[model samples]
Target chain A: MVWLLVLIPLLLAVAAVLIPSGRLRPWLVPFGGLIQVVLVVFAISSENVSGFQGWLLLDPLGKLVLLFISVLFFICSLYVPGYLSLRAERPTRLFCACLLSMLGMMTLMTLSHHLGLMWVAMEATTLASAPLLLFNSSTRSLEATWKYLLIGSVGIALALLGSFFLAYASLYEGLESTLQFDDLIKLAPHLSKPWLHAAFVLLLVGYGTKMGLAPMHTWKPDAYGEAPGLVGALLAGGVTSCAFLAILRFYSLCVASGEAAFAREIFIFSGILSMVVAAVFMIRQRDFKRMLAYSSVEHMGILVLGIGVGGLATYGALLHLLTNGLTKGVLFLSAGNIHRAFGSKLTDDVRGAIRRVPMSGALFLAGFLAITGSPPFGPFISEFTILNGAIGSGKFVVAALFLLLLAIVFVGMGSTVLRVTQGTPSTPATATDFRESPRFVIPILLFLGMSLLLGLYIPPQLESLLKNAALFVENGV
Target chain B: MYQLIDPILVAVLLLNFAALGASQLRTVIHAIALQGVLLGVLVVVAHNEFTIWAVLMACAAITLKGIFIPRLLFHAIREVSIRREVEPIIGFIASLLLGGLGTALAVLFSNTLPIAQEHVGSLIVPAALSTTLTGFLILTTRVKAITQVVGYLVLENGIFIFGMLLVEAMPFLVEIGVLLDLFVAIFVMGIIINRISREFSTVSTRNLSSLKE
Candidate 1:
């Protein structure tokens, strides 16, 4: 089943290249996505406990991450066909192949237990996603692609250094040097404190770059802004989550070594800093896509903060991962529709999305509400849990500040979203442009429905998965 | 022979100095290529191994670093028709002095690390890190995309040197993967640089700064 999760996408990527018809290629996306999701279901149901040593693994955390990636990819895949169809001049074949390849690399990243293997997969994700960012091939897209490549490459390089430090930490402990997660965990207690400390910091900064956590988040806005809507959705909702999981894996090692407090401090500092950065940027954000990018940085902050707060907050953080992923999917896809509708992402230019395309506008508005942590939304529940955990942990000041930041972000994002969704259509609506095909609308609706359902009820199985994932983080391997 | 290699490390350091000092684009690329060749030779000497695979990898590194990259860059420079890196955001002497300070700081920081290995002292990691920092500094301070790519290559060389300290533990496959990725990355970046030069009439990142807030 684990093999199937990776295999289906790999196969689809090949088929996308082998099959020459551009029209036939777009279908490959949703088809591959759905098949991967089905395989994920099978893997989850079978409860496969075996891990392919020195390479892939299906631990509890991996399972949860795999599920998230699958679900997000499934949603984004539904949107891709319509997106590619609309951009009729561009070749869809490379786009489909790259997207599926990205999915495969991310799947591999989630399942990877060896640090070296994980690094390779993460690097592969960066390589695969660069072309996706360059889908439009404009000067702006080129700049974004360059920034993404350079920053991601640097980050991965630092991660490799950190992995070396981790291996060195084992040597310091008089244990056989290894980069396997299980082996590292087994040797955790004997590891040198200083090397472990350095390793954790390096890993956080490196992975944090990908997670878009504050100071290291310079590339997110540009890349997300330049990439197509579906591409943005996959990156924000899928790639970042996989990166977060990678951080959690290392955090688990720190916890086992009883050095978690040190790691938590770093997470808290970076997370809060990210929140402040996002809040400041969100205020004056004119471009809707860029605004979504900042929102992603903010949520990443919240996710890290949740983990930093610890205990039940870790559960909240894990849940926030799911919530943030789903909300971002809804927001980016719908925002894409709005961008397509107005032919601009500038909030000043895009007015009355509701009046323009009623379904997309409503979904956009709802996504805004959902993302801002309004009641009866997935993010709301998750944010509240985080606050509860913070307060329970006696971090009252942190909780207060967290709430304040959330409020500011809410106002900032809400004004932008509301401005786009509620105003009268400034442009005279052409009959041909106002109507988005069902292909695009269905994915937005699907993601919005999932998020709304999550708000209403937490399924027992998913609840268990989240709980187990949290435990895995708290207990290590 | 090991003691003789110390001056080569100094030569590597001087190459960075030369990079900082050189105003002409051609000189900078030449200095970087020299630094690459020096590092490649250093790798062979330091390892004291003549294994075919390791030697081939070393030669490939030298070729990519000293020859292929510089050649591609010269072509880019010709195509862009830019003569010098004008208005480098920092003056040459000051940047060189800062590079020195950065190198000094790297040594200071490396001393604080609790490295138990006695075979190699703190100098290698610190030198590599300082060079990496200087490369980053060049990348940010310089406006020209070609110079930035040169900076990136220098940065990768720094990382490669640092990786040498861990070569025993780091698998060959991972090393190969890193090199391949780096090659492709530069190739793609070179293509982007060409496109940027054509569209914007300049490869300065400032010209591409239209998408900001």
Candidate 2:
């Protein structure tokens, strides 16, 4: 069953590369996404299938990220068919192949129980996304691809070093060296303290770079700004979640080692720094897409800050990962529609999105409100929970700062989103031969609806999943 | 017993300085390629006995890190036809000085970390730290994209040094040289380095600043 998760996508990716029809190729994305989603649903709901031992297993954290990637990909897959059709001038053979391959690796990443295997899968994810970033073939996209690849690889390489350090930490303590998470956790108490601390620092810096954490988030703006919206949605929502999952694995190891406090300090520091960095850069941002890139940095900060705060905050952080992933899909996909309509991602050139592509534009606006913790949106619920967790744990200063950063980001993001959505439908935008097609708009609507539904009520099953995942991290077995 | 490992580790350290100090791109690549080959030798030398895993690792390190990666880099430079000189953001000599200072600090820092009794006096920890720091220095200070790749290679090589200490745990790391080879190909976008050159007409990352705040 675990092998099926990786095999289906790999086979479909091969099929995508082999298929010649430009018209028929992109359907492979949704095909692979649907298959994986079915597998995940069955895997989670049935609970009868035994997972592959050691190399692959879906724990609560893995299950949560797997669900996020599958849903996000399925939504983006639906968007891709429409997206590729509009740009029918170019071939999408490589794009489809790489996208499918990325799904395969992301699935492998989620299911990988071995640290070395996870590192390989994560590196593969970085490789798979490079072509997607460069899909436009413009020089600017080339620059974006260059930065994204170089910076991302460096981070992964650092992560590789960290993984080696972690393995060595166990060996140095006179234990048999194994990269399996189960063995590491079982032996965590006997691991060398200094090496464990060192490993945590390097892993945080390494994976945090990929997660777009501030001070290490130099690649986010360029990559996110230039990629097509569907690609950005996957990169932002899907790839970053995998990195967050990687961090959670290490953090759980820290918990097993009884160094939870040490790990939390680093998380809290980096989290606040990311939010502060995002807030500073976000004000008066000219490029709307680039502004969204900063917004991603801000949310990543919130996710880590929640984890760092612990107790209820850990649960809040876990829930926010899903909410943030869904909301970002709404924002990026809708924003993509607007970008397509105007053929511009700059705020000066594009406006009146609401009047132009009413469905995507309204979703984008609602997405902004929801992302900023506005009531009735899912992010509001998650962010409020994070707030309760922070203050509940007597982190008054962190709580206050978290709210202040959220307000600043809201004001900053609101201005850009409103600037893009408020004015009369512009001449060039309407002239781009783009329209509010149901195919393009439905996915955004589904994502937005999900977020709204989550805010109104938390589903009991998902609540259990979030609780289990949080417990897995805070109190590793 | 430690006689063979000490000289090899020293040679690796010398190559680090050579990479840091080289002005020409060809020389820098040569230094890095040599470092890659030395790292392969270091893998075998660091191990107490020759086994299939050690041999496989040495071969992988030589093939991927020592040969294949450098070949791809050379192809990138040749295809791009950029100037052979490495244009440093900070002067090469100053960077070399900084590299020395980092090496010194690394030795100092390694002493602070507790080590197993068997490996207490070995240079593996300090040398790895220094090489990684030097790699980072090259990446930040160099202006060209290819040099950045070189910097990354050095960084990986440094990390490779640590794996020598935990061979039992990191068996796949012996095969990691192949993964390292893939890093250059994928990061350089297989053949898109040529396209990047044609688009921008230069391989300097300085020009990539057009999209910035």
Candidate 3:
């Protein structure tokens, strides 16, 4: 059974909590992440991972999400030692435990075929990650955690109801109200039309809120902006990825029920609205960290919009998931270093980052370019494919609007990023003990390099994984 | 004849209004706690058969949602020592009217669903939905963070009511897991509320406006 994949990190987290040494507990994070990565690689390499009646199968979609989360968690794990060593005054015990448990929950979320188990796992994730926001113990962070919990819990609560409506959908057809994805897919044709539609709407709003989709994306800017950069990266990349995977499972159900067209239309509208919201906020954004938050909102928009446009766009959406995640790792980590050196998130206090921390400043700039779809980066390739898919599908207005918003965000974000990266270091910014350590710095460079490599060459293995996952989502093959 | 579950469900729905119309924090918390107890009873009363698993789940619900979590909320309010919802965004009567409108809408809406024939006339679906809507109303309308937490518990109680529709098909493990998650969520929220009250000297979300751009 693949239960081992999830249980190990959780067990290790408990161990981390029990360990007497505060200094040693933070190190447990990287160790837990490494074990998770190794186990994920092994699970993907060797088949027959299902157990407990097909509830834990590593299907192509799950495999792909598993791979991204593993990579994201592993990289973020490496930075933990560097981050915590600098902030020794603060306690790392709960932070380390929550971080590891979050990985376990995300893994459980992707792997579970049972919708009931998935909801349990998904809600568990919200509970686990809540403390990560409160790590800083500041009033703003406290407020952020408050909004995060209240809004996010309400959102996931709706998802719980959505799960019920879905199970009830099966019951309406005289089938046993089984929530296993395979069973639901097999019985999709017989599911009641009205209930199925209701299920989709609720699941979309519910998971969409978690995914930070527009109108429902209110909590994103607050939590992401207030969280420490390391936690920010995880929330943006790992937490949101789990939520997106949940949506994909439901999207697949829609495909099976032949509500694919209706789902696509809703996805398209939500996708575009998120970008417009992101773009509007991106303009005149003063805080560099908050700018990255809005950027996350935009990329999340692109992910759904890509899939909604269909065909190769689905493949692009899957690939975009990886690129966007890695690029966020680069941006948030580098931004973390800069934030420490400068002690401010706003552009006003953070002038001439290049002069202050040469390497990180350049990265924050390059990350901005790469994320905005400049050439020779993975995001650009994935984004181009989506635009091509839109054009190929004759969604010209969507394509045009997509292009326009991309430009506006690029220019909007450009001013803030450039203002941070360029110019002379303001004199008061010079005296921080914080320095760019190669330990944390190397991770960002590696992430950027990998994104660059993917833009130039799609590894055949990843390409195949994306293709199979896309096909699985679009057609229940 | 209606099953024994219907009146209990009505009591739960009325508690939704009690939570909305009541201004005192303790009273609202008590109403939600009572609703939680009703929902726990709902599981056994609504079940088609009274197996060990069903009885055990109903007990679990009562202890966690009814007794344990509400006690936590009570302590939270006691910690903050705020007795009333004090200065709601909308005053009490208007909020009650809004709650009534939502209850009406929920009743009208559940009729549109193709619920199972055996469960058609039961207040299960509409009561579940309207209670949920009332929870949202309290959450959005109330200013104090403790009241918001109470609103959240009420919301979960409503979802728990809806969860009954699938109690027979759902594994006991999932039902227990759901309750556990709800407990932890409240636990975390309670902790944060204490922190917020200490930090700002007030738990009103109005003071939370500093984080905005």
Which residue pairs show collisions in model 2?
none
Candidates, ranked, TM-score: 2, 3, 1
| Candidate 3: tens digits of C-alpha lDDT, residues B1-213 | 237878898899888888888877778778877877777788787777777877887788788778887787776667776555556799899999999999999999999998887787888899889988998988888887777777777777777788777777776423744553464446435564457667876667788887777
Instruction: State the TM-score for model 2.
Output: 0.98
- TM-score of every model? 0.96, 0.98, 0.97
Residue A242 Cα positional deviation in candidate 2, in Å, after optimal superposition: 0.7
lDDT of 2 at A66: 90
Per-residue lDDT of B31-104 in model 2, one digit per residue for the tens? 88888898888777777777787777788788877888788778888888888999999987899899999999
Error of 2 at A94 (Å): 0.8
lDDT of 1 by residue, A404-477 (tens): 99999989988888889987988778734746768879989989888988899999999999999999999985
Q: What's the chain B TM-score of candidate 1? A: 0.88
- Model 1 per-residue lDDT tens digits across residues B104-208: 998887777677654355357687778878887787788776777777777777776666656555545336434533643454345544567767776677776
Sort order, lDDT high to low: 2, 3, 1
Which of the two candidates, 1 or 2, achieves a greater TM-score against the reference? Answer: 2
| Model 2, runs deviating above 4 Å | A48-52, A426-430, B189-192
How high is the TM-score of chain A in model 1?
Answer: 0.98
Give the clashing pairs for model 3.
none
